[model samples]
Target: MDWNERYSEPGFTYGTEPNEFVAAVAGRIPPGRILSLAEGEGRNAVYLASRGYQVTGVDGSEVGLRKAQELAAERGVAITTIHADLSTFEIEAEQWDGIIASYCHLPSAIRAPLFRAAVRGLKTGGVFVLEAFSKEQLNYGTGGPQSPDMLMALDELKLELAGLDFVHAVTVERDVREGSKHTGLASVVQLFAVKR
Candidate 1:
C-alpha cells in the first residue's frame, strides 16, 4: 500500500481522535515516554501527549509524519515524529514506558521481529498496547490490509510477545468507525500487556 499517497489526501486518513482502545487503556501505562508505531496523522500520539505522556510517533510515510506534526501543533501538544520504516526502525532496549501499535499491519516476516523488539524496548512494569485487524477481517470488508499475511492472529501474538504478562487479550468482531477509511464491522485482536 502506498501510504504516502494515501496520507497526501486532503484530511487525516484515520481522523484526529485517539483509538477507543487506546483511550480506554491509556491510564494503565505509567507516566513517561511512549513510542507509537505507525502513528499516522498523530492521533494517538497527540492524545497521549495531551494526557501528559511524552510521545514519539514513527511512520514510514513522511507525508503522514508531517501531518502528524501539524496535528500535534494544532492540538497544542508536543509530539516528536520520526520518518522510518517499521521493519528497520530500531527500538532501544528498556527505553519506553509504553509502546503502542494500532492498526499497524505488516507481513509476519517484518512484524515478528518488530514485536520482539517492542518487548525488549519496554521498561520493567511498562505497558505495551496493540490493536490490529485479525486474519478473519477479510470476511468483514472493513478497513485493513487485504493480504492475509498482513493480518494478525491472537495466538500468534501471544507467542511473539512472550515475556510480558497479559492484562487483556482477545479477538472480537466489533464496529470500528475511525475515519473515512476504517468504518464498519471488523474482526480485530486487542492486546494490553505489561513487561514483568
Candidate 2:
C-alpha cells in the first residue's frame, strides 16, 4: 500500500505518542537538535520538541508530513518537516546531535546506505537511536514489512552503525501499540549508539 494513501486517512497513523522505548530512554539523550528518520505524522519529533529539543522530521510522504505539521501546531511545538526518500536523502556530515529511526525499514540495498548517512550525520558525542521490526516479526503479524529482507538483526545493525559506540543493542519480543496498524506482540531490534 502507498504510504501517502495510508497516512491520508483520519487521525494519526501511529497515534500521538512516541514509541515506548523512545519515551523510556528520552532522559538519557543529550540536549541538542534531533532528526527523526521516516517520522510519519511527527509524533516523535513533536515530543522531542516539547522537551526543548530542536527537531526535524523527514518522511517520503507529503501527506504524512502535512499531518505532522498539523500535529505540531496542535501541540504547540515546532518541528521542521522534510519530504524526501530515505534512499536518497542526505544529511551533512556531523550535522546532527541526535538521530532517531523508529520502524523505518527498507530493503538491504537502500537501508545500508541510509545507515551510513545516519552515522555520518551524527556529531561527536551524538546519539543514534533505532527501533525496528525483526525478521521474527513476520510471525507476530502486528505490523511492519512482511519480507525478512526488510527486517533488522542486531549484528547487522552493529555493522551498519560501526562508526558509533554501542550503548545498547538487543532483539526482543515486546508488545507494540501504535495506532491500528502496529499493535500487538512484535519482535524488534532496538539500538542506542553514540558517536565518539
Candidate 3:
C-alpha cells in the first residue's frame, strides 16, 4: 500500500490519542531519549515528548511524517523524526533509553530482525514497550492487516526478544478505539521489557 498517498489526506489516519497501552505504561518509564518505530503520524511521539521525554519518531511515509510534525507543532512539543522504512532502517547500538513499537506489525522475516535491532539499539537497562494486534485480530473486524503473516503472536515476540527481561507480556481481547481505522473490541498483545 502507498502509505504516503494514504497520509496525503486532509487529516490524520489515526486520531491524536496515544495508544492506550502506551499511556498506561507512561509512568513506569522514566523520561529519557526514546525511539518510536513505525510511528505512523506521531501521536505517540508527541505524547512522550509532552511528558518530557526526548522522542524520535521513525516511519516510512514522508507525508505521514509531515503530518506528525504538524501535530507536534500544534501540540507545542518537539520531536525528531526519521523518514525511513523499518525494513532497512539501521538502529545504532545503545542509542536509546526506551523504544516503542506501537502497532508495528510485519511478517516474521521482517519483524524478527527488527526486534533484534531494537534490542541492540537500546542502552543497557533500556526498556522496550510494544502494543500490536494479535493473530486473533483477524476476527475482530476492527483494524490491522488481514494477512496472518502481518499479525503478531506473543510466542513469536518471546522468541524474537529472548534476550530481554520481560516486565509484562500478555495477549488479550480489549477495546481499542483510535481513529476510524482502529476501533471496537480487538485482540492484541502488549509487551514491556527491560534489557538486562
Model 2, residue 31: displacement in angstroms? Answer: 1.1
Error in Å for residue 62 of model 1: 0.5
lDDT (C-alpha, whole model) for all candidates: 0.95, 0.90, 0.91
**How much is 118 displaced in model 1, in angstroms?**
0.5
Model 3 lDDT vs. the true structure? Answer: 0.91
For model 2, the superposed segments whose C-alpha errors exceed 4 Å read: none
* Every model's TM-score: 0.99, 0.98, 0.97
Per-residue CA lDDT of candidate 1, range 46-132, in tens?
Answer: 999999999999999999999999998998999999999998999999999999999999999999999999999999999999999
Tens digit of per-residue lDDT, candidate 2, span 1-59 = 58999998888889999998888777778898899999988889989899899999999
Model 1 residue 71 CA deviation (Å) reads 0.6
What's the residue-level lDDT of 115 in candidate 1? Answer: 96
lDDT of 2: 0.90
Candidate 3 Cα errors over 4 Å, as ranges: none
Q: Once superposed on the true structure, which residue ranges of model 1 sit more than 4 Å away at CA?
A: none
